[model samples]
Target: MVFDGLTETAVAGRPAWRHDASGVLFRRVPGGTYQMGLSDAEMAALSAHADASVMLDDAHRMRPIRTVTVEPFLMARHPLTVAQVRHWLPDYEDDYVDDDDAAAHLEDEWLDALLEALPFRLPSEAEWEYAARAGTTTLTWRGDEAPTEEQLLDRFGVEAEVAATENPFGLAAMGSLTERCADRYGIGYAEPAPADGPPVVRGGAADASPWQGCGEWLLALPASRGWQDMFTSIRPVI
Candidate 1:
């Protein structure tokens, strides 16, 4: 019932995210193959239901719904916090953008320090969705369609009060906050990653409609790329 630290009960039966020495929390994702991306019929149906405010011009970017085989890995139970990032590498800010300028701006020692200090890294696009799906076929880990404002508050609570309640996999905020993903990809499966394609932030934030969470995914620029919002956070996988 408690998610404070790694427990035999939590890790023995299912993969779990528990407190780490650095104060970060992580869950285990057992390896397996799963469908990734939208199907034609689902896309058409989703497009019909898509809200005008959150319209995505390119749904094809996540298409072809391929079956991906992943290796067993550990995932952050919650999005990485500014405090956590700073703990491992003191200079990284909470809203540090992961873009080219930011990367270039970082002290040469930061990356190496990050690699050495923590046993975590960002999750790939495929790995992210697979964990988000958590063995479901619907748009959300919760349901098949967009949810309402009431739905989100009731489910996870603001500030992750009830974050550990629903997701069977024990990974937090897959449908709530915009956490960082590792892939630098473009709009279509066939389209090559833009020479400038930035990594993506997955899941929906509190400010947006809960209905949008199932379909929300925003892109982030490289390092301290001033494009970050309050809801932007990091969810590293190892």
Candidate 2:
């Protein structure tokens, strides 16, 4: 879980930064305008079922279609692990019953580190989708040749399971792992807080429930403040 020194690069003539932390290399993603949101097929899938429980509706967690614009920024290449977050805020407190609880407690420190390390903030629902898509127009980032349940299961090294095609960026688990997805307007995830709080994690995890990774959109519940976990522990984009 050791992090190497920061590596520097230039984007659009501006100095960009990247870091290798916890065996993942986070590279700065120069932001630009891109369409976001679910595809017709996805919408149809949600609408095909009239039962509110299985339908895709805003009240039921579906993001309404919309247009959005975003500024350039950086993001982590992968989900932040417990070991990674512990690097900076060794004393991160966990109030929940399990690792999920620990994730919630360390949120504040995570934000703090992110702010200190770069001139950016967490990707908005719109931003998250734009990046996850990595410039593609498909149900999931992977494309129409969606992975079969078997393929996805194989990737996870588990029993047979369904798989959503990844977008062009090689970002697996966007639809399967995380609910955050691009709509006609932009990217969005389930808001972590009911009133006000930091953003929640976007991608799904291996430890989540089977329903968590259903072909439907995936998103994590928000737990703590961004600064609580010393963002250093979370992944960072160059």
Top-scoring candidate (lDDT):
1
lDDT for each residue of candidate 2 in 1-238, tens digit (9 for 90 to 100): 1224656554323343445443333434556776444545555544543432332443224343446577665554444434444554465454322452122223354445534654323455566666666766544444434233332311322112211322333333332233211122212333433433334444442223344335322222111011121222233343
Per-residue CA lDDT of model 1 for 159-206, tens digit only, reads 344454336677654655555566675665566666566555566433
Q: Report, for every candidate in turn, its global Cα lDDT versus the true structure.
A: 0.53, 0.39
RMSD of 1: 7.7
- Least accurate 10 contiguous residues by lDDT in model 1: 219-228
Q: Could you give the C-alpha RMSD of every candidate to the true structure, in order shown?
A: 7.7, 9.0
